[model samples]
Target: MKKLFHIGEYFQEKYSQPLQRIGIDLALGCPHRSNGGFGDGCIFCTEDGARARHLTRVGLNLVEQVACGIEYVKKRYGENVGLIAYFQSFTSTNAPVSRLRELYSLVLSQADFKVVIVSTRPDALPDEVLDYLEELNEKYELFVELGIQSACDRTLQEINRGHDFAAVKNACARLKKRNLKVAGHFILGLPGEDFNDWMYTADQAAALQLDAVKIHQLMVLKNTVLAQRCNQNSNYVKPLNEYDYAAALKSFLQRLPENTLLMRLMGDAPESELISPRWWMKKGQFLSFFKEYFYSDNTQNGNFVLTHTADGTPTLYHPRYRQHFHSLAGAGSEAEKKFAEPSALPERLQKSASEKRPLRLLDIGFGLGGNSFAALAHSEKVSGCALEITALEFDLRTLQAALNLYNPNSKEFNILQELINNGFCRCGNSEIKLLLDDARNTIRKLPEKSFDLLWLDAFSSDVNPELWSQHFFAECFRVMRNDGALLTYSSAPTVRGGLFKAGFTVGETPSFGRKRSGSIAFINMPQEGFVPLSEKEKHIIFDSTAGVPYSDCSLNAAPEKILSQHKKLVERLRRRGVPKWYREKTVKN
Candidate 1:
């Protein structure tokens, strides 16, 4: 898993303790809501513009609001935690420099805050305001949080954002020029936006290389234009579920610079105020979920939970691997598109039937047996040829859990329990031999030139680098027939380079629900219909330091050892200017 930088971690390193954030709403108001600007604020703007709930009394001055917020935080979290004064709500810098100085100074006098953060619109920051904030930061730690909701200008117009992406770019440039820390506040699942649009926002945000970022899933609140629009047209807004939102966030987190601080990852609102997407969890629960899914190795944890994919099929998610047994987009769809069809399982089975022989298949990391079942289903429809499946799995708990999971072919799945009991079984017209062990150990025991189709559907190379190393690929190459094909969903340069090093002709397959294409390798010359590597993939494989493959001489080293060796090799190569060609290629393009 990629390392993420969190604000709590930052505070612990710098201040030696966590900081309890205090939200102070100055009631400066928004320019877009005023008569001089658009006269109507953003569609998602609420009545209070997200004011802190504790500061509820009307006509409270800056000092009073600060006092109320301090009392509220200190009561909830003991007095020992440090405080960070957050100027939240209603375009914090919309007022004049004189008024802003007076409001900002109130929090400075408290002498309890270690840092100050002010949230405002990108268009609200003028040169005069930037100069004043820079001056203020010279004496104290200050951060400017700009609301860069979406990178797509079209979505900005659809939401009546009253600004463009250019404004955000300009504001960040000005802030960075002053050496002030900038944190971007981005929202996913906005109206009239898709996953690609959200990724565009993340990519652009990463390009800016800001000091920190706060990401939130859009929550429709009562009395907001978004809620009314959703009421009028059901399709106006569709909230992301936990799985999809986590998938998007995973991509977002992977793209960010490792040093950038993650201030927030989820949205929060009072139950009474939320109008849609009611799956809000408390901060503790949310952080626990984040750590469990993104941080833990889960090697000792065997709990497997059933989850439904986009194609409405049951799949299992393992906490240890921090990945689902199948793709979240569609478990069954991935089995067909990325595995069966790409490998031509059906066509190969037909050829075997003509020769009066069973088609041989080797399923490595056969979690829930989706790939095998998909191939079997296709072969049954095409012909009556027997399909011989040798499945290698590391965890028996996943296989047991799959027995209770709902699938279209429940009867065939139920027969899989026989494999658990007897290590072999007959399911429909297929012969199944299950090897319950790690693939690295099990693949070596197989005979040479045995399998015709190999499904390398293991966890990602990031987590399971052992399975994708050159030594393991050499074992795969020995077991596979001369005319066989190996297919996997990973398109990482190291995986491809390992295949090449193992003496296989590598190609590509159309990816399913992902940006990068899947990989296809052949022991012999690839067939005429196979797609060659794209230009970008070719460059990565030959020119970049990223193409360096992991090596394990014994083919049974621990994942940590393999990853460490690969990282050291890459660093050594980098110092030798191995990636210079790739850098120059990118620049030329």
Candidate 2:
């Protein structure tokens, strides 16, 4: 509800009529003006004009390029969408203001064209150019995309960005003053940059109030300055592991302001142009790895509070905890008992021949498939009840790992397979199906009122905020039947608030093992004679500043505002008997 507006979203909305995108090759060189040196621009710069060779075949002039681009977009995206004339050549605004206006006007004069997007350097923008952009914006939707590779001056210089860090700040401020939307482009894994640098970049972007941000993992482009550097020294650039990149991205997202539109989490460089990090060739695998990390990790945007310097730069501090973990691997031992307790289902709901229908169970965050196995075991206990389990996993490899760990030939695997094959397995007396994908997106695809029971076993809320927000919880609520119940290992106040907001009648239940005293349970409907939040219960919300119950239907619900209003409720609850762990997580100032 925070008005998420990514570049793609903007394009899709602006061209609600008909959208067309035409790539124009200005053939204009860099502003630096080198004598027959190709400008040797940034290390990662490409001279392919950001257009495929086929477009070049027609002609290199502005009019010819626009004509070719119009045909390409029409063929590729259908004829209905209006056209976006993209000036993708090297530093589109590097030419004189008069030339820039003439070229932009050529594309604008076309009847199908609806918008113009200019990609340029911050240093290139003069007052006269700003005026031209203002004029352009008045006529059509204009987007000014700036390439600010990193917030750290050291990193910027190391990459040979050819500009000072101050230029980025100046450009952003100027764009805002002109009432123009700005998109900041950044690259992770640049030379000499580590995970901390990526985090710092996100913090800087948040502070700068960027409307949208685009992040790309660095790859050495063949024949480019970066490749030459890497070739000169083997250790000049080290490719990040899939896991490391995912973790870095998660951390970056956690620090990013919630309102910032994330234009892209990743980008694809032409295979012909790529050099190192061979693994990056598989874009699908890279994306899958990130998805898996999100489901298994519990951290949200703004979860880490920034202890700042006087100059408003963020400094490092401890991260906020928003969820707890229960160990299921050592369930039979005393150690395991410390984290989780044995299942305590009512006798009526226990395994019985009369309840012959397959037990429909939903397992969220199917990381490692540990909880899915547990659910299978539970179904087995319910005699004659088939365990129809829907296990949602975000990462394909993790799902593969889970399948390998729990082989079909094994006894446990056989039980789960039987449920899938015959609707029920007598050994475990349960049935299950594995749904692999991001639960937030995948859950919406499920038919409404389909699930009977849901196992909310995702990572702690502190690590994965997108999945824990009121918007996602509402989707969970809709998919569940009126009588369905949700069980999770989280005792965090925010999770409780989200559940309540989704219209669940939430209450504390005794937790298993040494993990904690209780877990949260949410019933779809309140008990027939149950009283709404009592004074003591209301106090918990106030004390935690956890906010009012966020139903999925609520629009534009700002997390900060919600938290502020419930501060007293959180405090009052803390005064009562709240767990030490719960009380330790204070509201981020």
Candidate 3:
């Protein structure tokens, strides 16, 4: 596995231990701010001026800020960890040379700090500043981080970044000439830039031979010009999703020099201030993606891209559906919570074992067999239990990707491998029949009243409505025994209504990882474990137009056709006029 040349590794190699940066605000503000106030700062700059959350430099002196920063770091990490004095907030070199000397000398007085880091814009790095930094580098290790947000001059102008690419080039040239270590801060997904533009920026940054680089995602923050623009027109800023950002970051890392240390990969804006691109990924999660990018084959079989869910299990993103194979919260976790527990897998397995019969399961849209494997693993725990699963899947490339991902349950993993390679797999008392075709076609041929439990793990109704239609639910109801229950991760009103329309008792399941609860249905009266929907939920399904389910009597219609028909049905229903009480109640609620 290829490892990232990270700042931590570089620090450990040079200083014998990892160094934690203590961000210190010098209070020397940005020259780009209008009237030298926070209101008209750079479009992306927040009022905090990128200051450390704990340290407010309003009253504290340079020495006092350094002391507070050190205390904060030691309290979080340990007393023995090495420290780096970081002049982080707005242009650190905006002040005169004499003032800079006093502030720099004051912070250097602390014997515990091993290095110094100063962050400023490319335009702010004058020759005098570079000359002084060179003198300081002779005595102690120091790095000058320039805010090179983009390489495209048009994009720089669009973001109100005062400097252009030439400024970055000139700044790097002067810094290198004086033997000063240079670092560049680049942001991906900026306004008016596409994938090629981002690539150009990365290539330009690499050409500078930067000693270190900090890559950030352009985030919309509160009380910024970007936020105001977003309020005016919502689509003005659309951030890259996790998959695209990972691809861009990996490509960016590949273009950088092998020795260039990666200071940071993604941005970490305070949630309270952030307005867009709210990915909410922690440092560790981002690093896991970094490791996955370098080690794993991200683009697999030319059909899917590999990504990790909340529980760190692998899942694939389908380009055609624009959906992931499993929930982002957790693939295995979703399988166990949303399907196994809701369907009462353990109790059913025990009953089947006691009756000396295999528990029959219908796994619909079984992309990668997460639900199947989880069920089999649960069945494995019940000693004498036997399980027979009929898994229906559409894509063959998905099965190929599943074979590549590592699973902890060796038995289940081998079973999936066998099922993919062959048509069926028999291991001990468990059997899985793999049907590689449209679920709508294969489901019609299934024996009636055969399955004891059904796992309806399909994509969202908007993208794959053919599987979630009333007709499909009726087919699932036909196959399930009277006592059998169907469980799905979707709590959409249309899905519950479809189940209700198909002569099944519907209820909500305990929610996991998302706001909406999962849905459970039964052919007859609901089981004791099922919680009935509230009156409002029922009203939306039975009375309101929103509850109207997609209809595909033929069962094998294209998704686009089904979706278009469903939209027309909804429009016609709305045109027919809704009852006043239902309309008011739903609107008020």
Question: How many collisions per candidate?
Answer: 1, 47, 0
TM-score ranking from best candidate downward: 3, 1, 2
lDDT of 2 by residue, 1-589 (tens): 1233455666676566655557676666666435432556777876553444557656667666767777777788777757777666667887778998887888677655677778778888898999999999998877787889899999888877789779999999999999887878888899988878888898888777877777777877787788888998998887764445566777776676766766677767657766856552267756655555555523332222222223332222123222222342232232122212322332213533366555456778655445656555555555555656677766544433333335478875564444334533444444456665667668888988877667776656545555666677788788876766666766666777777777777665544544443333445453233234445554565444554333223434444544443455456655785432324346888
Query: All models: lDDT?
Result: 0.83, 0.62, 0.84
> Any idea how many clashes model 3 has?
0
How close is every model to the real structure, measured as TM-score? 0.55, 0.51, 0.82
lDDT tens digits, residue span 184-211, model 3: 9988888878878988988898889999
- Residue 314 accuracy (lDDT) in model 3: 75
Candidate 1's residue-wise lDDT over 307-331, tens digit each?
6678988677765566788887898
Best model per lDDT: 3
Query: Highest TM-score: which candidate?
Result: 3
lDDT of 1 at 162: 89
How much does candidate 2 score in TM-score?
Answer: 0.51
